[model samples]
Target: MNALFFISQIIGTVSISAILILALAKLFSRRWRGQAEPARSRGYAVLVTGCDSGFGHHLARSLDLRGFVVFAGCLCPDGDGARSLTLQSSSNLKILKLDVTSDEDVQQAKKTVQENLPEKGLWAVVNNAGISHWAEIEWSTIEDFRSTVDVNLFGCIRTSIAFLPLVRASKGRMVYVSSVFAFFNCLNLGAYSVSKRGLEAFADCLRVEMASFGVKVSIIQPGNFCQATNILKLKTGSDIWEKLDSERRQIFSRQYIELATEYFLSTCRAGCEDAGPVVDAMLHAVTSARPKRRYLLVSAVDRVFFQLFPFLPTVLTDAVFSLSSMYATRTQMLHAK
Candidate 1:
């Protein structure tokens, strides 16, 4: 009875403290400078990539509702998901098929966006296309890492170059959909972490370069969102697993793969990353009178996690990840670790 009472008291105290902090944040957020200020017009046109599903699709649709012309790019425009979005939206929504790695496809999309715009070019371009990875560093190859960086980081730069003319003409903005991993490395996420780390550097350089041209570049670092798709689906490492020795192949087992993939999805589903937060941030980046250089869409805890990670010693972080991978291996009942 005493223990229960003590637990309840702690919970009550924490709840009160949380409310107070939130109240203060609401008050102070108003005075925060550099961020896009409240309630701005959405008359400009915007382009977003990877709009078949998840964050890209959500942002494209949300911007369309705000009266902005949205040119949404998907891998398959004639597919069910793209067709569905196109059918539902009015003529203001345009869907284009683009694979960022393909120079031809990217060039074509560039031409289409330029042709479709009214006298004013785009108000903003959202680079939301990316892939995910969760594999041990040793088991994953340079090729695997390269593929991720190619799409997630280098591809972003390519898209920006293609759209620079339009953005400059309209004095628009660039929003890169980076991840919390941009500044932090989590267990078995080396491929993604390194790519995002590179992206963070690129975004910083991009801001300085574009600022002179009246272009604003803001990077959005969102935490794990529960949207349908995630990156554990990539297997640059998986395809050649059997070619390696038994010791290494064991580490890349079917069970190991599935567990790692599902774990990310499970944690994502636990949170209510309401589209509201992202949409709100998007509006600020695109429509605000003055936009910030970086918008972290992650929770306060995630921000803290990223901040603390760089200070941690390499041995400690590696040990923690080693144990985590071992735990995932243990869960593979069929393999019987």
Candidate 2:
């Protein structure tokens, strides 16, 4: 009994020590989390994609106000969002008609930015444009996956290649607005999650490659901010049912589909309403003297969960997800019975 008690005590001490070391390391990090120096940022130009809404729109305005010459790139330059941005922001903000998927459009945008740039070159390119889709793997079509990847992954790649020269000249920053789904996959968001995961991989590779040059590559992984952003419309259960063929309809009951869709929508609606943390992370990545390689803009609980997931045993994690899946669809299961 004494030997067993001693062993347990040793284990406890080791665990506590490990936790303390991690905490201290995090706290003592030299990264500054403050706003960019005004004088240094005055003549620098920043190109922000997806400025039609959400983070891109907000960040463009903020950067403009902070004295950076802002190139706000929107898919529809004359759209309401872009027009409103022009009216509200300083004259320093120029609206660029940028469609990330089109090679012609991206090339034109690069030319436009080059024509207006200072001798210092483009200071940053913020790839904030992305699309989100939710459907079970089998329920989602190839087109669904392709569309999500086209916008979320390929779009960033196109923008990066087009702007690499100017950014390399300035030794500037490249920031990709990724999602927490890049960390771990969630139910029914497979297409969106896959795109984000690919984006994360791309960012990691580019980070290493850009080290030779002075360019900094950063990725911002945000948790659920569905209500705060226009990323997801409230897609109804019927929409999923309409897409399924007779065979698939037989495989999944109408009631099950309805309940599952309800669950997904409910989870999204229950997500964090404020995009403040995400925006702050993006700003820090862009303007801070020392930005982190990856910024996780999640809640404290979520941060701990995701950080720990990689270290846990696969069986244990799988079991936890299994239970979670059962819990999430308990009502549907009961109805089927």
Candidate 3:
């Protein structure tokens, strides 16, 4: 009885302390946070990568409508998404053929923006181009790792370096669209988590380095919006199955692959359908006088999970993930049968 009472008391005290801390933080944030005036958004030039679809496409259109000169970089300038954007958007929006993987393309984009910029220079650069793949580490190929990292990590670095001069001149913000996976690794998303984690690290370093130059760096860590963004619409596990050797295939059967794939896809599709909150966070990062260092656009449940992650015991975390993986793949059942 005494132990139970002690535990209850501790839990109560901790909950109260957490609430107080949150209240204080909110109070300070509002008091110290810089407000973005409506007029400040007008005539600002913003560059957004991967505008062919997803967040980049939406952000470009939104920014243009807000009176910012938006340079939308599309991998396929003549693609359906780009064509639709051009037709639907105002004259302030320009679509550029930008493949973040290519240095030549990035350099050309920088030149184009330089010639088009007004006296204020480029107001912001939103690095939103990225790709994701789902596969177990053993099922993944070297090319898979390279392709995912190339687009998510190296791509951002290349674009940042090319446009740093313009952003510095304007003292504008550098906003990166990262993922919640950066905070914790998930099964079948090892490569993606690795890439986003690297991105978070780079953003942190750049933020500190650019502080003296009056350039602000912000990272937008959004939770699952895979359905709205169609981020995983093109991804599948068929390729992984086909590429595996005979022995590897025998070890992990086709049924296991199908089940695992279904689990991954279903989980993704079940996430938030509305992507407006993510875009809102991105806009705030770009337009606010003093943006947050990291914007977490996750649901309340996810917010709680993120907060508890640091305090959770490693063994507990590992056991939970391990059980999840087992449930998805059913490795033990496969072996038994």
Candidate 4:
């Protein structure tokens, strides 16, 4: 009994020592959470790309209201997305043009960083600029593949490398706006899925690589159908649309578009308000003493189901995809007609 008691005491001492060492380490480095940032600085200092539409613009505005100095960047400031953001005045908000695919734009952003934050590193850089091509592998051209990579993958690389030092210096965070499609597959979402999967890998690698440098990486996987501007204007009259004949278009209008549109619009409406959750997640990455490595919005239904579908028998998965394709095929026919 005495021996057992001694062993228990030793274990208790060891555990307590380990915890104290951690506390001391945190204190000595002065690297843990700094005091909450002042109202002027906002709660965080964030630079977000692709703010011309969708998540980026909404996120920027959302952060602004919460007292984060937001640098909203995009390719064009003329569109409705840009104009709406541009009209807003937040001394905390600064709108800039950043074409993620262009080296020149990337460099200019780098210079702007030195100019604005010569003394302090940015708290976060949100890489949100990306595009999608919803088509099967057979329909995807080499150029299509290259374009997708250029914008989604290569653009992330540029922004990360350019802004990595700031993240390291602030011991801040990098939020990669990945998609549920990264893990979930869709038949016609080939090019988009491929690129997003690469992004998921990138985030994983980045998190590990930057851990020691006082940097962390996080991913945001938002679910199905947030309404972004100009979706209705997608080149529906292009050659791609022509492939869907009149009979197929008629079939889709009767069968799927209504339900699909309703799903999309409803999700987006909820998502607009739910923006707070993701913004809260980003804030944790930016200011928390300990940050999470991954976050999923749990709203991406098709992609979520796709992730699980692979675990099912191949035949079952194939059957599910086949049914989903029928709607798209009919829509294609309508578009063509």
**Root-mean-square deviation of candidate 3:** 6.9
lDDT of candidate 3 over 218-302, digit per residue (tens): 9999888998785684545676689899988888888788777888888887988887998898899998776889888888867
Q: Residue-wise lDDT of candidate 1 within 255-331, one digit each (tens)? A: 66566556655665675556577667876888777677777776776677566666889887666665675465555
| Per-residue accuracy of model 4 over 28-88 as CA lDDT, tens digit each | 6764555544223444478898898767877788778777777888788667777788678
TM-score of each prediction: 0.75, 0.86, 0.86, 0.69
lDDT at 69, model 1: 83
Clashes of each: 0, 0, 0, 13
Across 1-337, the per-residue lDDT of candidate 2 in tens digits comes to 9999999999999999999999787656623344344226778899999999988988999889888899999999999989999999998899999989999999999999989986566899999998888988878899999999999999999999989988888888999999888857667889999999999999999998998897889999888889778999567788989999998887778787788888888888898888778878888988887778998877887788877876788887766666676455754564564
**RMSD of each candidate?**
11.3, 6.6, 6.9, 9.2
**lDDT computed for candidate 1:** 0.76
Give the range of the ten consecutive residues with the poorest summed lDDT in model 1.
Answer: 33-42
Taking all chains together, the TM-score of candidate 4 against the true structure is 0.69
Off by over 4 Å in 1: 1-43, 226-244, 247-273, 308-337
When sorted by lDDT, best at the front, the candidate numbers are 3, 2, 1, 4
Worst 10 residues of 2 by lDDT: 30-39
- Evaluate all candidate structures by whole-model CA lDDT and list the values in order: 0.76, 0.87, 0.87, 0.70
